[model samples]
Target: MAKLWILLLLVCVFAGAQPPERSKAPKVWDEKALAEWATPIAGLNVRPSHIRPKEYYDLPVVSLRTYPVYAPGREPAGYWQRIQSTGPKPLMEKKGSRTATEWIEAGKIAFEEADFFHLRTLDPKYIAEVRNGSLAPSRVLPDGTLFGLRWVPTKQGVALSSSNCSFCHTLYLPDGARVPGAPFRTIAPRPPETFKVWPVFSRLQVELGVLVGSPPFLMPGLSVGARLSQGYGVPWKSDDPHERLKTVTQEEYEQLDLAARSSGGLPRWNGSIIFPAKTPDLIGIQERRYIDHTATHLHRNAGDLMRYAALVTSAEATRFGPHEMGGPDTKRIRARFSDDDLYALARYLYSLTPPANPNPFNESAAAGQRLFQREGCVNCHTPPLYTNNRLTLASGFAVPANAPASLEILPVSVGTDPSLALSTRKGTGYYKIPSLKGVWYRGRYLHDGSLASLEEMFDPSRLQDSHSPGGWRPLGTKTRAVKGHEFGLGLTPAERSQLIAFLRTL
Candidate 1:
């Protein structure tokens, strides 16, 4: 056999002279090595390779990813701009140094004494003693006593680790004073005096209320309805076709279209819009690098809050809920946060910002901002801060051939609408590209609020195909189905009210 063909041509010339297999690849960690490994844990660090997760979640993700890209108001001429060019306290504070106005009045008196709702009590036997790990969700002291007198640290019932932003952004501390809650009304219920839950607007619910100072029409839907009630560990059986979904029966809507054409329907979240879904306002989320609302983890701060407090809390929070975090003061609220109060509540939520640019250039919003950049939409809406943040796929989404290798996916640019990621429960068509900057009071919009306004989002008969709860729906004649970034479609009705007067000045 020709000596086995001369030993297979000398093993194919020693595998093509050996030098070509050098691409062991895998190095992609840009932004100058993630700003030198996030400068000692992101205290104003920024370097996710100098912007582009839609400008690093609409700007300032740790001083623009760990400093040095100056320009827009440069930053050199000294004395911190001659002490902020003679300031009164807004060169990022320090004029009269009342020690940064006494840590902003001791963070508004520790956000009004940890928003004291009788210091924390949900009791329906604390959801079956957090599903039998045996009762524990502490922080009590207004007489009912408990602020660490102990219990809550279960391993598979829920709550063993918490940097405590009111155990997942639902704060109010009323008799204590912090206010903000809406997501499926955990209480505080009573605000609809014309409080539009939708009617149009969503560049990701106004970039998640400009990266988390959120208020005007709040969001975070009770921490995504406490992450779908701790990832559906109970509820569901109202007759089970995924919780008796409002009057089915056409043979259970043909067995929910054969269970959404087999295996990709119930990861869920729109629980009547997560019981009102609000409470997120972690005062500018560590200078907005990104977290949830599908913006996943692009350069997130606090090591993505210690990987969502070790995967959203103890005993691997049962792979994210349906029970875990032990009960009975789970070892005294894990000894009342001492990692310097979890880096001072992530440095008071990365020093929150947003109350400044209240409507800067309006000539009927500059003719609806030249018909919103002559309708090509400045290519994913670019500007000082309109949105180029990046993540596409809204048109007719269908990418899920079993996604989740920790979802590094992308690709959906051709006119986005994808019938609610092929009809919901997060059917992985990938999302995240958000940010527009407080579109004049954020309201119900996509990521499942469905659409509500911006003039029914340019009504081309609400994008046909018989609109059901499929996607865009929000405002009334009741069929919303519209999906991702479809910016002011085919205008004209005074250019959709001058692009809603240039999105009410962002």
Candidate 2:
């Protein structure tokens, strides 16, 4: 009996000592693989011009101290200097061979650390001062850790401070709960004075001969400032150089101003042709077959998301490049980041889940769910993932006959604004039908963010030229009509309320 027990114990020990089964690693793509995988569902007939070789121009050597800066509630310069004296810690810690789960973990870190927008305009000292608590607690969560911004270590101690994808996507609730992959709701419109700062800086840069060009002029910044100022009910200065350099015509600006005031919110970008944009929630993005408001990029798989991340980050300079181009350009960048990094990032993004809804379905919400299907909302915002993952043509965009069927262009127009699909670099002559999941947490509805709430969307007064009694009015204009997506305007007040309740449950 003792010998038999001993034999069984030995067998157990040997089994435990053997290596555990390992999960398969996520697939990493090489350049060739990525190109083949991302082959446009439809071949693009309208190819952009070939990039010319970069010309080296002499840039002015300017002292950092000469720059005038302002951060509303920042600490004195000496405090920042003191912190900088201590070397910055590395943003990412080293890890071993990455499994699928490990890739997700690494991807989360990358999402927080990566700077895709190239918005490194602020002095590092200012960022440090503001982050260290001179500014409001808007960016900090209940845990006392920062949410969107981070101070990364550079070779010259800790000079780089950047905003990542989380800056716009992460939402901090009113009760101090922090939710990742949610659309930001607390962002207040920038004051007119705040908009004035960047133009001053850009003018200085041009005067110092630091930047010499026309197409790449700091127009994006200037446009944003003008849009913000107009949204804030501030008068536009006709003689302002920033206003004069704008791509948007005076009539377009007037329409934008009217739209902003009517919605009581900022207007989203009319493609790149206008200013501002609706910040999209990142939850459940993995299921999306297309990306961007205009559905410019058909997301066949995770690699597409990684390509986007690369284009937005350190590789942004290559967007309209003379040499290496990775994004929309024909040529690829000279130095490409490892496919593993993007794979990890995509895995992490795919892992994100929406926060659990505190509100459960009630009798009214159940009725609303039935209405949701009956009202034709289910056609575009389909069930399960809540999107058909197809593109709808803008009201006026004429689809080319040679356009490939793989592009999945729908014949119907939802009557939404067509400018974003017609005018911007991202315009594909179609607008992607957006998923309705998490619509409850989102605000300033529609592609342009022209409506502030779901209730406001059904308001009949929105279709009229004059402001409605209880409806939201744009900041500057008295008589502005909010048109498009007029599906549920006929719903009774109680039905609308119930529908909104059901939407929150999504």
Candidate 3:
């Protein structure tokens, strides 16, 4: 027995003596891959600007998950929910809408059912079972939604519409257009996709279907539509995944992608929304200075939430009331909603949070930070929250031109009253500044996503007279370029590289 024990011990000792193998830790970006990404966009100041002192915005912070999947109190709701909870108070009511208790009581009814997770699974039978004015929680069109694309439910008809919104607005890639004097054109191997964790380059292209290849402005999904149709319009011809991205003319591309601009000669297209953009991700939306493409401001408050819901979901187009965009189908939906239901949605929207992760504290990125301040990118995108949260005509884009001349007559932002502007082509002067929190996760960067990658944003060649055909293409493009954040016009390639490294750490 002693001899057998000795032999076993010797075997164990020999096994332990074998060298321990080292395991590789997962990297967000492989060093080489990150370098490649930064190479083309060299010299842009991507580091967070430190010129301003960090003044924390006291926005509400809430947990994102809820029990029973989407229960109101257990898991905090997102901005979409909070925006809808304002209920049916008149936008100009002196006394405001309802008591806190009253809202919650009614909100519970709305909250119980007016959730996407819940609605996505509802049986058609359940939808049919609800009687008008039922007031019962489960029976109250529990699956009602403003539109699949919106972050929070709104009274706007387009907000409730599906696929169309997502296709036009979210996940956009730049058309590769350039600013008046930029030096580089935005270039990328693929189209934009939502950013998750990374090995980034290859993984983004292969698995998540980040867009790859030409007509840089085209969204990958839309490219898919074009390839399938073989030059036809949306509702593409085929479902074959491989055959969906053939090159086509810009007009042809838009034809397949955008809703018709002028259907049978009316002012609007058959399927277009006033704002055809996709509802952005809400993970860090509380930090944005602005809310809509029009730059409609929504501070993190209950009153703004109420107005958003009532204006977007309510059936009537009464000045401040909801505007239905879904034809006859929407009229039926609006009839079913009440003020209390709106409150639930508002409650949900105000409760959003950025996705969780510890700050990377990348040392290499520190060099980039210095560059950011040196380059003056800090004026608009001030940090740690990363925005001044102020509105300016800079984002007005073409909206002012397209609007009636009366809008031009109004004093720019502060001088004009919002109420009057609400009724006219132009009214409000305030354009909310968006927060830069979580900018890394979004692609088709910028409010319009005109640029394909960050690289195109900084190239000086993009700013030349030959580049931008119609002034600066802020969203970015292929032919012209999206100028960099105007930081580091004098940066050397090596320093620019370090700066990009720091940006990735954010």
Would you list the rank order by TM-score, best first? 2, 3, 1
Off by more than 4 A, model 3? 1-278, 287-289, 298-300, 315-333, 336-341, 357-359, 395-432, 461-478, 483-485, 488-490
On residues 13-89, what C-alpha lDDT tens digit does candidate 1 reach at each position?
99988753211111122344333332110111111222222322222211000011122233345623343233221
lDDT, model 1, position 414: 43
- What is the descending lDDT order? 2, 1, 3
How many angstroms is residue 389 displaced in model 3 relative to the true structure, after the best TM-score fit?
Answer: 0.7
Better of 2 and 3 by lDDT: 2
Structural similarity to truth (TM-score) of each candidate: 0.26, 0.68, 0.41
lDDT of 2 by residue, 275-378 (tens): 23466778889998877776655577786787665443323332211222221322221332344556667878899988777767998899889889889899
Where model 2 places Cα greater than 4 Å from the true spot, the runs are: 1-97, 116-149, 187-275, 314-338, 467-479
Candidate 2 clash pair list? 116-312, 116-313, 261-473, 261-474, 261-475, 262-474, 271-420
Instruction: Summing lDDT over every window of 10 consecutive residues in candidate 2, give the lowest-scoring window.
Output: 59-68
Superposing every Cα of model 1 onto the true structure, what RMSD results?
Answer: 25.9
Global lDDT of each candidate: 0.34, 0.52, 0.32
Which 10 residues in a row give candidate 3 its minimum summed lDDT?
262-271
Tell me, by TM-score, which candidate is best: 2
